[model samples]
Target: MPKVVLVGERELRDLVPLDRAALDAVRGAFLALASGRVIMPPILSMAMPEVHGEVDVKTAFVPGLDGFAVKISPGFFDNPARGLPSVNGLMVVLSATTGLVEAVFLDNGWLTDVRTAAAGAVAADALARPDARIATVFGAGTQARLQMQALALVRDLDEIRVWARDSVKAAACAADIEAATGVRTRAVGEPRAAVSGADIVVTTTPSSAPILFAGWLAPGQHVTAMGSDADTKCELDPAILARADRLVVDSLAQSRRLGELRAGVAAGAIAADAAVDELGSVLAGTAPGRPGPDAVTVCDLTGTGAQDTAIAALARARADAAGAGLATDL
Candidate 1:
């Protein structure tokens, strides 16, 4: 008899906290992708330009894992106008031994959020300066808050700066961050001002135009750009890649095809095959991270299927240990 477990959003959230366990799982996933024979296919993206939305399907299999995750993620930018959440999704966990459905997680993109935040931690751990004291987040949104927490795990962040187009939102984000992290936070007025003099910067906006520039970056700065996951999206100026002493991407192929690297290369700002480092390689110690305290580093993360599969497996384990999900036959 085949069996399947249905894990709902609340249960997954309760089971998985945005803490060290999640970060370790994501970090391990990166290392596996670097060393293991993990098979990950290209992301299948379907765009709805008229509706201003897109859906992407991602899946991957790690050789030794007992199961894998296939996920469907959708984003509708205009949903807020209709009083709806912009992002929603689900994941399917399948057993590797029998190729049977093991569990279905109605996470609504929560797992994606956690994994992506964890990737930021991995990047900061690899590239950010050891004495890093402050971080600047380029958008006041869900990711903006998460990035602050994730970065703190790796760096000694003492303060945070929040920037958004709307001043009210920016202030609110800063206040919330201060309350949650017990770290001093400020609402900066300008994008360039937010970038200046900060040890670390994280761009989390879903912008079609550039909001960060090379000129704003000082020596010894590290920037993590996680927003540009689609061809039409860009957050950093193309020239920023040229200013970096080290450029690491979550995946070379994905970044070249869809992320900020596409914008940089298409504009002739960076080489098409520039000795781009992969985050996984850096994590696995096959490649070097930031060379010194004065080196400028950039990490572009275009969320990977390996992350989804890893997080799904983690969620399944947690739910099973807690006896939380509803189980049924397939």
Candidate 2:
């Protein structure tokens, strides 16, 4: 029998914050993905359309890590109406040497939120102009607020504008970001008004249709699309990919099947065999990012199993150091 540790969300939040350490962990994951022979498979997704819900199973085995993580994430969109969160899940860490369960993170999706936002920050840091200031985010959900906080970690943001279908929620989200980051933040009624003139634009919605159009983009602007992780969801117009000077994705294979690139290819806005750069390759300097200040760049993030493994490993190590969680032998 192996000893297994169980850590809850409240403790995990204190252990892994959305700070430089968390950012570095995710960044290192991308670097390892690019430079090492990591074993990460395609996402296993099950759609429960009858209940407006979906579950995704993701995992990865990095070469140097002592353990790997298998995460099960479920999103029930209608849960909010029932006084429940829309997203919740846990991660199971297994020993690399013995393949036995070492720990279970009952983070309830907090880890995913942190890592996803960190990935967005990494993309903006790598692709956005060094002097990028203003930012616009579409969607007022958890990711919208976290993305702004994460961007504040890497970029010297001056202003953040939020736009959502529900204007009231957008205003609340804007107020929260301003208070949290001390950056001037506001809510706008028009999506175009939110996108125009922003140096970095991030779409964090679970919108099924296009909320960001191609014509709204400007040169020298960078876009991070993190919402289109499912085949049915799309935030950016397919034409936006066609118009980007440099396009990047977390995983080319996943993007082709589940990210915005799928819509682009289906709409013929981008080539089926387009030369797209992976975020890891860009971070590793194997591929180019933002060729010049005037270039328009876009990064499509469909989320990845490597991130779960990375964050989980970090949480487990930190918990051990802090003497957190409950250990039991079975």
Candidate 3:
């Protein structure tokens, strides 16, 4: 018999702690990804006027791990019009031994948000400069807030600047983060201003055009672009990519199809052999990171299935440890 567990967003919030353990899981998954132990297909999605969404699948048979997960996330754009967020979804966890579902976590996308942010943190821990301090974030959405939080785990941030088209939203997010982290958080007027002097700059926008230009980056800076998870979306100037001393991605295949690399390739700014390294390779010590203090590094993260699998496993473990979920025999 298989047991299914349903955990709502609030319960899940209490169950899973996005701390070092969660990040270690995600990092292990990425190492597996580089070693070809994980199966991650290209994400697929469809959109209508009222509803728009994407379905991403990741299955990892991590040597000592028990379960794998398939997450179906959908976004109804009209929900925000009704005073709700545009995205909602759940995850299905399966036993690795029997391939039978062990649990279904109706986490309502909160777990996904945390895990993804932690992935950025993992990338930063491995690729971002050791002295990274000044930070810039380009979105005021939930993910943007989490990005700031996650980066703090890896970098001793000194100053933080936020930018959003909506001045009010950016101001509110800045104030909230400043109060929470005690970092000098302020809302800036331009994207350029947010990025200038920043040792690490993160872009979380949904823009088709470049939000970050090469002219804004200084030597030894690290840029993490988390916005281009779709074929039509890009958040970095191809010119900036050309200037990068090292270009790394979470997945080579995913980066080609949907990450900032896709945009750089289209613009004739990056060649097929242009990638300096993959984060997994760097983490696994197969490649070097931070070759020099003057090197410019860029990490393109098109969220991977490995991350989903890692987080799902963490969520299930937390649920079991806390005895927090309803197990329905099916």
lDDT of 1 by residue, 1-330 (tens): 677899889988899878888988898888888985888999999889999998999999987778999999999989999998899899999898888888999998999999999999889988899899989998899889888887777777788999999999999999988877778999999888888889999999989899999888899999999999988889989999998899999988999998999999999999898889889899988999999999999999999999999888889889989988888874
TM-score of 3: 0.95
Better of 1 and 2 by lDDT: 2
lDDT of 2 by residue, 1-330 (tens): 878999999999999999988888899899888985888988888989999999999999988989999999999999999999999999999999999999999999999999999999999999999999999999999999999999999999999999999999999999999998999999999999899999999999888889999999999999999999988888889999989999999988889998999989988999999989899999999999899999999999999899989999899999999989999895
What is the C-alpha local distance difference test score of each model?
A: 0.90, 0.94, 0.83
lDDT (Cα, tens digit) per residue for candidate 3, span 275-326: 4567788899887877788888889998887788888889888898888878
Model 3 weakest lDDT span, ten residues long = 49-58
* Inter-residue clash pairs, candidate 1: none
The residue ranges of model 2 lying beyond 4 angstroms of the native Cα positions read: none
Top candidate on lDDT is 2
lDDT of 3 at 166: 95
Off by over 4 Å in 3: 49-61
